[model samples]
Target: MTKYSSEFKVKLVNEYFDGQISILGLSKKYGMPSKSPIYRWVHEAEANGLNYLITKKSHKEYSQDFKLSVIEYHKLHEISRLDTAIYFKISPSQVNSWIYRYNHYGVIGLRRRPRGRRPLMAKKKKKQTRLNPTKEEKYKQEILDLKAKLHDAEMDRDILKALKTLRENDPNSKKQN
Candidate 1:
């Protein structure tokens, strides 16, 4: 299971320390799967004091105001979807959709909707074909061409041998010899 923030754990511990809630109740309240961590938090708080429990600060937000700010930031600044994403550390497509919503219906457009289709690469693998002939095919064609050249060479050799025998047998061949 994921660990809770120290501030949140400390707050729960504080609440338990005040005797306002039970261990089981605190576990259920924080949606913690185990009650042991809560017990540990309370014991640690008692032994080390509240300062040990309050290790970090958490954000407080009003959802409506957050949405309005998002809309205003996009509109007033005239920021591109990609630029807004870089500023917010979100995807450009998310910023694009938010801008589309703000343009159509004001602050209501910034509210997150169900995502559409996933990316093309996320789907099944495609069977790709080679654009050029493979090494094996090229080798086979080269062997075929070599065989044709060898046959022609052998034919030339046989023709030259037959001419030599005929010239040697002729009376005119003796005059040159």
Candidate 2:
């Protein structure tokens, strides 16, 4: 896929919004084969806070479990794709695509499939690689994250309780309600 500069996308999107030309006209003016790419770019800019789309690509492999875990984390926390992508060290668009794939294909969609010729033998595994967190460590980290979330929820509940008490005690607040 051809990578377009973020500035180029924003310029076209601004032009589209400026009402200077129709979508079809913009496409033709830019030597685009169709209007859809421009439309897609503008839509993405609006949706994702602009600029960052698919950036430079380099080959990287993620484990199926890791992919599913990232999606699961997203579903559980309801975090934004941009945040999730940052936490996962991937592009936001990639996380968005994963969500789409998971919705359509389930867990099977996340499994890594090699595109072409296979190696004669699997590459020798490295010891204590920085990338792979052990299962126990992952579980512990998840537990800690959940605990923090729970603490925040409890604090919110306490604050709400205090506010309710205060409102009940205040004759002025009751009148406002």
CA lDDT of every candidate: 0.62, 0.72
Residues 1-177, model 2: lDDT tens digits: 665676777778889889989889998888888887687666665666554444556868887668777887786677877667766767667799888976765555565776999777868864754344556546645664686588679889999999999989998766542
- TM-score per prediction, in order, is 0.29, 0.40
lDDT by residue (tens digit), candidate 1, 43-158: 65665566755544443233434544554556456665544554554434555665575556544434344467867675767688523535653554455456556767888999
Best by TM-score: 2
Q: Which candidate is the best by lDDT?
A: 2
Name model 1 segments beyond 4 Å from true.
54-177
Can you give the lDDT of residue 11 in candidate 2? 79
Alpha-carbon shift of residue 102 in model 1 (angstroms): 62
